[model samples]
Target: MNRENVLVIGGAAGIGKQIVLDFAGRGKKVAVADINKKALDQLINESGRPNDIFSFEVDVSNWESVQNMMTKVKETLNSIDIFVYSAGITKQVSFLNIDWASWKKTIAVNLHGLFFSTKAVLPLMKNKNGGSIIIIGSGSAITGSGGGIHYAASKGGAFGFMRSLVGELGKEGININVIAPRVIESDMLDRLYPSEGSKNTLKKEIPIGRLGKPSDISNLTNFLSNEESAYIHGQIIIADGGRTFRPKSG
Candidate 1:
């Protein structure tokens, strides 16, 4: 029996939710931590494999909350073989309109929270001496588009942070990588391109001629954590369906 334990931060909705479902479907012991209690409860109840999935409440921006959640997760999961950082917040505001509160909050969730969560989980993953750390990054970090100045800056910091972390952590048999996705069908996307016309226009801009789905990310998440991707580390894989850096399609 394969008892690989997986922990997904901000796993109640969007891409994180799909990742949780994907792992649970494979019979992995999957745990979801999110700030939304209602969504967490609902997801657990709706998930057919209740025994395979567990939920934890966490405020990624709050260090104490993150610490408490990780402690509970360690006790329940016993080990964390794969840690996916998918907790992020974004807004499509103009640069000049960006206020201190908004910038701080965005950086807190997208970067500082990453710092806290990664610190909390590193010990557990190191104990196993072999694991994968997947950061749910954004193309905004590269293209300087989508969300706003704050969002792009935060993600850019996260990308650089993990790339540096890979140098040391990889030596310990853990691989840290970033998956920067764009134009995905997410709440953030809905907010950024609310109207049908806007969405259609953005889709046409993509060479794939469509918006990306959560599964596109979740599927790659699956592969990245597998043994086949062991050699892949410290890389930022962009999955935007040719919206930005177009990959050679099959």
Candidate 2:
């Protein structure tokens, strides 16, 4: 098996870190990119077998920075086989209370960042005859949710971006897909909600009986980034433990 070179944006922590580690453990060369230099170093140090892990500090929200980071990753690792846009942010602001600045920031990170990161890597992937672009969306992207209208809108845009990119790039052998996860246990979750009881209650309401761990999403990402999913394109796979399908009886 030819080991794939994977570049995971926002891989310093959370689900993105898990994806980077998983790919590295499989003997693939992994580039962990993020704006958090300390966290990036922490992931590299924690990996133990550090040879497979490389760190690049890049803010995905900045188009030029992301482009430069992609160039460095390709130069250092030869060629990238997979690109994962696992970088995102969400806030629990009421629609009426969310100021334009806050909403714009959410859009920049959650939607625009995905666009910049994926666009930067597409050319490199096209040269290889194809590669996988995985965007981490959210359950809110599909359903109406309170207090996170901006977040939901950004994710909805991600779905649109993935499908459109797939249509235009599939002929070039590139596969684009979005994996929308339900509530997941990660630093982002901790920061966004910050209430343990609330988080726990939300987790229990899910049909899966627990919040998704970073590994759950990472496992799905691994599959989508591999040869097995070559024929799969432009699909939004919801890995929310059937939460989206449960009857709203309450």
* Each candidate: RMSD: 2.6, 1.7
| Residue lDDT tens for model 1, 169-215 | 97888888999999899887898889999999998788978899999
Q: How far is candidate 1 from the true structure (C-alpha RMSD, Å)?
A: 2.6
Error of 2 at 28 (Å): 0.8
Q: Count the backbone clashes (under 3 Å) in each candidate.
A: 0, 0
**Candidate maximizing TM-score:** 1
Give the per-residue lDDT of model 2 (tens digit) for 176-221: 8899988788877887768989888777678868878999999999
Clashing pairs in 2: none
Error of 1 at 174 (Å): 0.4
Give each model's whole-structure lDDT.
0.91, 0.85
What are the TM-scores, per candidate, against the unseen true structure?
Answer: 0.96, 0.94
